[model samples]
Target: MMRQRILVVDDEPQIQRFLRPALDAAGFDVETAATAAEAKRLAATRAPDLIVLDLGLPDGDGKTVIETVRAFSSVPIIVLSARDQEIEKIAALDLGADDYVEKPFGIGELLARIRVALRHAEPAGPLPGPEAFGPVVLDRDRRTVTRDDRLIHLTPKEYDLFVLLADNAGRVVTHGTALQRLWGPAHKDDAQYLRVLVGQLRAKLGGEAASLIINEAGVGYRLVTS
Candidate 1:
C-alpha cells in the first residue's frame, strides 16, 4: 500500500525532527522544509497529500504560503503554530488552511486532526444527490449552492458552514462541532463566529431558505426540511 505524503513546514529544526519520525511511525511519508519558499517549492514539486505548516517561517509568513498554494491546489493543510490567538487561528482558516494546531499540542490530537483533514479531502464514490429544503439545493459534490435554480454566492467559510448543516439536514449540528470542523480544535468555544456565518448564510439564502435554518439557543442550528 502506498503511503500519504505529508510536508512539514517549520523553521525550528527540533520540531521538524520530532514530527518526521512521529509522522513516519504514523504511516505517512514525511518531508520537511524550513522556509516558506522551500515549502511552496516542495508543495508544488512533491505534490504532498497533506501539509503540516508553521505560521512563522524563516523567509515569509505561513499565511502567505497558504494563500499561494490555495491559488493552484486544494491539498489539505494543517497549520502548526505557537500563536493561539483567536484572530490568528481564524485568519489561517479564512485564508484556506484545512486545520490548525497550537504549539505545545498533543501528538495524538495532531494526528487525529491530520486524519480528519485527509478523510475530508478524499474523493468519495457515488455520493447521494443534492439535499434540498424548499428552494435551496446544496450539491455537496460540486460545493455549489443554489436557490430556486439561481446560484447563490458564498465565501469559502460560508459555503463550508452551509454544507455542514446541509450534510446533517433536519438534525441539529452543534455550534462546537461546526466551529471545530470549519476553523479548528482551538476555536470550538467561539460561538460568535458561527453566529455571524449562520446570519450571512440566512441572508444569502433568503426567505423560506432562510427559515430552513433553525437556531436552537445555547445549543446549535438545524436545517429543517419538513
Candidate 2:
C-alpha cells in the first residue's frame, strides 16, 4: 500500500513547521497549506486519506472549506483549532467534520485518532451474523444486541463502540481509541464521558456481560477474553 498522505492545513506557520517534519519523519506524504485557497488547490489534485484541518484559515472560513471539500469527497476530516466552545464543536461536527480538537494537545493522541480514522473511514465488506463475545451476542448486520437473547438498545455511538470492542475482543482499547471510533477527534481527552457511557453499557448488558468490559485506570479499557 502507498504511504498514506495527510494534508495538514493551518495558518499558523509554527504548526506546519512542527507538524510537517514530524509527519514526514513518520512516513506520511505530508502536504502543507496556509490558506483555504491553497488547500482547495492541493485537494483538487490530491484527495488525501485524511485531513488534519485548522479552522482559522486566512483566506476563508474553514467551515466553508469543509463544505467545499465534503461536496466532492467523504474523506475523513479532523478539525484542529483553539476554539473550545461547545457551539463551535457542535457546528463543526454537524457540518460533517468527523472530529475536532482543541489546541495544546499531545501529538500522540492526535496520531492515534488519525490511525483509527484511516482504518475505519473506508468502505468495508459484509458484517458478521450472530456473534458471541462473553455473554453478549450481537448481529452486526441487523444491529441487534442481546444477553442470552434478552434485547438491548444501544445508542448509535454505543453500538459503534460495541462493534469495535467485539471485533477486538481480547485487546486493550485505550480510552482515546474508543472516543476516536465513536465521537471522532474532539472527544479523545473526554475520558469521563466514555467512562459514563461504558458504565451505562455495562448496566444494560447485565452483570455477566458487564464484567467483560474492564477499565484499565488512566490508560484505556479492555474486553476480557473468554
| Per-residue lDDT over 5-121 for candidate 2, one digit per residue giving the tens place of the 0 to 100 score | 999999998999988888887779998889999887777788788899898888887888788888898888888999877656656665667666689888886886677667657
Scored by TM-score, the top model is 2
Per-residue alpha-carbon lDDT of candidate 1 for residues 88-176, written as tens digits (9 for 90 to 100): 77678667786677899889989977886787688767886887778988887888999999999999999988878766554446667
Checking candidate 2 for backbone clashes, the offending pairs are none
Error of 1 at 4 (Å): 0.6
lDDT of candidate model 2 versus the reference: 0.79
Q: What is the lDDT, from 0 to 100, of the residue 107 in candidate 2?
A: 83
Highest lDDT among the candidates is held by which one? 1
Candidate 2, 77: how far from true, in Å? 0.3
TM-score of each: 0.62, 0.66
Q: Locate the minimum summed-lDDT window of 10 residues in model 1.
A: 166-175
